[model samples]
Target: MSVQEWSADAATEIVRAHSGVRGALLPVLHALQERFGHLGPEATRLVAKELNLSRADVHGVVTFYSDFRTAPPGRTVIAVCRGEACQSCGSRELERHAQHSLGIGFGETTADGSVTLDQVFCLGNCALSPAVQIDGRLVGRVDADLFDRLVSDAAAR
Candidate 1:
């Protein structure tokens, strides 16, 4: 997870690269998020201006997509599955443990900026219910201890 600091110049370049293209908003947003780890107000403003759209319009899209982040993420992002299958498999307990241990709820980063907790609907691993995606790698049948170990390993990286 190599995230660059957000800068107006860098954002403008990214927005311009996707300007005038069909359905450029998504690509522009992805590029910006990829570079900065998240899209801030300034990035949204530039994107809206360049795309000839209202700031509200851009904001709506950002909010509508779970993949987009409005704030910087921690060095390691931990995503737990919240789909029906996962829930039925004791994922709810797992999620509670995570939140309690991290002292933060979903969509928030730890105070130390080492871990971020998130929830995804599914990871296509229903067979192994209670799946978790840590730093983009999917792990199935996750429990509290496994999650802690994974998070610890991720932080050490």
Candidate 2:
């Protein structure tokens, strides 16, 4: 998803729009991240104030949700499925190739900012083991060469 820079005015607008909802915190956080690519400190603080919650309260929620990111992600995110099906089909090797070649572990973006490598439990494509998701595009039967090519494609873009 495309994201705009964090603006207090813009964040305030987003926050205020959702503050009235029941259990508004999650929705508010999602909207903020959708706009800014992350829930940075200033935005978090703004939300805490608008929701009449403590910064610690908001921060705990942010950090607790795996879906929320506190910092900007790389342009492309590559997720390898390590589900039982995937693991039985050489996903371990594929996972190693991703980590070694990318030189970053799960949840870390490449130094060049072209990609972020992540390990997920499953993509639910067990029929085709060793599944991968590149920027939300599901791919099956991936190998080291294919992974490299995909990364190159993302970098070229």
**What digit string (tens of lDDT, one per residue) describes model 2 on residues 51-105?**
9999999999999988788888999989999899998989999999999999999
What value does the lDDT take at residue 88 in candidate 1? 90
TM, every model? 0.92, 0.93
lDDT of 2: 0.91
Weakest ten-residue segment in model 2 by summed lDDT: 11-20
Clashing pairs in 1: none
120: Cα error in model 1, Å: 1.2
Model 2, residue 4: displacement in angstroms? 1.3
lDDT agreement with native, every candidate: 0.91, 0.91
lDDT per residue, candidate 1, 1-157, as tens digits?
Answer: 4678878897888888876789999988998898999988988898899888999999999999999999888989999999999999999999999999999999999999999999889999999989999988999999999989998888778
How well does candidate 1 score on lDDT at residue 92? 95
Worst 10 residues of 1 by lDDT: 1-10
